[model samples]
Target: MEGDGPGGTGPVHVPFGYIVASEKWRGSQLAQGMQGKIKLVFEDDLTSDFYLSNRSCILYVTEADLVAGNGYRKRLVRIRNSSNLQGIVVVEKTQMSEQYFPALQKFTVLDLGMVLLPVTSQMEASCLIVQLVQEQSKEPSKNPFLKKKRALLPLESCLLRTVQQIPGVGKVKAPLLLQKFPSIQQLSNASIPELAQVVGQAVAQQIHTFFTWSG
Candidate 1:
């Protein structure tokens, strides 16, 4: 559980690591968001007792590395993959409040062999950035309602959105199908003819069910 995991092992290195890249920002687009160099600090260990239900693979951050003159620190969580890939860390926490540490810009899992499972979008990540900034500004204990507002959709929404984005969906019909079938798994289970009934034979029949094929 200690050094056996990826990355390595040490006092500060156990569950922590320095940010090598800001996944949310890259090149010119990244520059627009943060004027200074963007670096983050993250955690990759579990805090409490272990269980099958508990997400053994998760990441957190205690602080961030910020550049001077840049009004904001690179306060974002990130995850890393084996193929030199990096992404934002998406963990469900009761409430993350660590604004006290100005130097702590970001909190996430270290670049270990952890793959960031896709469940939400960059838009949701943007909303989280706003919430994290606000939470850091005040005593986290005082605010509870913040938890209710869902910044990111669950796996169901993710699948639904992806399905709707197909070329022929346009805008109107996409929402219609998404509203009816909330998840890819569910949609996949449905018969092709059933989908054709909703989106019509030509379009629906032509669309291959990625989920069914994979399943």
Candidate 2:
């Protein structure tokens, strides 16, 4: 991370909810549009257009870069290979740059596995950058990229819980009943007399009647 203090140029932490933009971005239209929308700290040492966070970097490819061809790709490849950080390539895709955008998209996204975001102009890229930074600033669990918590698994505790739901089976008796039967199939097939050995005659009858009850 780069320093945010006025002209200090020293290494510093990137505060949450702020952007560390490249010094080259100063005076650009993108920088102008970003004013008040997101807090930016410019640094000359930055390798990309902006560092959304320590884990993510942004590369801006303007209409001029598309006209230049293949050169921007080399820059992208270098950044992708050299850094472990997530790369987001923001490409300007207005009418003039439309033709070149497809090929550029293939190279950056399909080939490199880096994220590609299309914007009509620098202003749109600025807005998208703000959204990206906002997403990064929030708790990781709430981030869109993090997978939603997995569906509940059928764990042993879950099995014991299901067993305890049987009428007359409390927590203690649930495990004891499962110890002999091992599975629902084996437990259900057990006669009341067979189940009596573990849970005693009364609960044995209740357990047997619970699974076998048709009404």
Candidate 3:
């Protein structure tokens, strides 16, 4: 784990791997090429440093190895976002190690934003992360890469809006469903079981019932 410092300059010698954090895992499970030594800034005022998303790291790790209550047995291990780190990895077995401890209770886990670094023990390279974060906060990014925006569908036949026309969907659930499952054509072909997995069983049943009756 790194020290509590702004800009990089925290813990050094992050190991080759460790367990994955749940928050980092959730938002990044489907995304690819989001790994390696990219600079991480603490999103908002939460943690002091951010590294690569933990979920991305977990792709290389196994869930079974991540037992609850166990801290890094060694000093050079990478910190991750998980129930154990967040006080949620409940202990179901008593025979586990006595050293098993709960995670540091904190809000806003760090987000991994870049991937260009190899694990190193160099202090200067570690400081570079802090410098990058500090520099970023001082100047608005001029990089064209940072200025890109999400593309939206034209309003005329916007499938999202058309789905909103469904009865009982209303303002909230309609957009929620669209955001959850982006394509309307995908929604049309989605099995009730699949939709239920995205939404809840009850909501999925309602959506399937409505679409089946109407279409």
Candidate 4:
């Protein structure tokens, strides 16, 4: 929550869980206007200053901020994981590129959904922020760590571990398979055709044979 910033803006006192606007967004009307209304702070360089819980909700006004370079990208990744926040990067539609897509994927893997907004200006970005704030207010916030911890229930953990051991199944694919079949027992009980429907034929056959041998 602490970072370097210029003086004279005075101490910004926000209620606990208040949104902290990034210093980079000082130019935007929304940021400027909200200065006195909300508890806002200005930080040197951060993924996004306006966050619900740490990095739970971040707003990037430009794609350049995200695709700046390896150092910036790594910092973003760290923030994303540490806060498990929902990230929104605003840019023109034409600005999308293959180079940044991999970084987006990494964000997704951490369960931090990174959204790309093809917005033209701060006006549109501001509107989007209002909408998001409203929506976020409507829903109860869930802790990302608790959600991950819940997934480690004895039975569920064992099932996930067993499923990951299947040939051609890795961390990502194993989760997909679990979505289709909730338990390892059910997955093992499934027919080749049923398993194929979820994970394709070759891998399905491997899973079926592995379970068969174990049985």
Top candidate, metric TM-score: 2
| Residue 51 accuracy (lDDT) in model 4 | 53
TM-score of 2: 0.60
Give the range where candidate 4 is weakest over 10 consecutive residues by summed lDDT: 3-12
Model 3 agreement with the true structure over 72-118: per-residue lDDT tens digits = 22211232322211111111112342222112111101111111121
lDDT for model 1, please: 0.32
TM-score of each: 0.34, 0.60, 0.26, 0.43
Using lDDT as the measure, name the better of candidate 1 and candidate 4.
Answer: 4
- Ordered by TM-score, highest first, the candidates read 2, 4, 1, 3
Task: Estimate candidate 3's RMSD in Å.
Answer: 16.7
Residue ranges of candidate 1 with Cα displaced over 4 Å: 1-41, 44-160, 209-215
lDDT string for model 2 (16-128, tens) is 77888889899888988889988888777666777766546677899989977878887688667753345567889989998887788657644664556678888887887
> RMSD of candidate 4 to the true fold?
11.3
* Cα-based lDDT for every prediction: 0.32, 0.67, 0.32, 0.50
RMSD (Å) of each candidate, 1 decimal? 15.2, 19.4, 16.7, 11.3
Cα lDDT tens digits, model 1, 27-102, are 4322233233223333344221111111122232222322122222132222222222122234222123223222
Structure candidate 4, residue pairs in collision: none
Least accurate stretch of 10 residues (summed lDDT) in model 3? 105-114
Candidate 4 residue 113 Cα shift, in angstroms, is 6.3
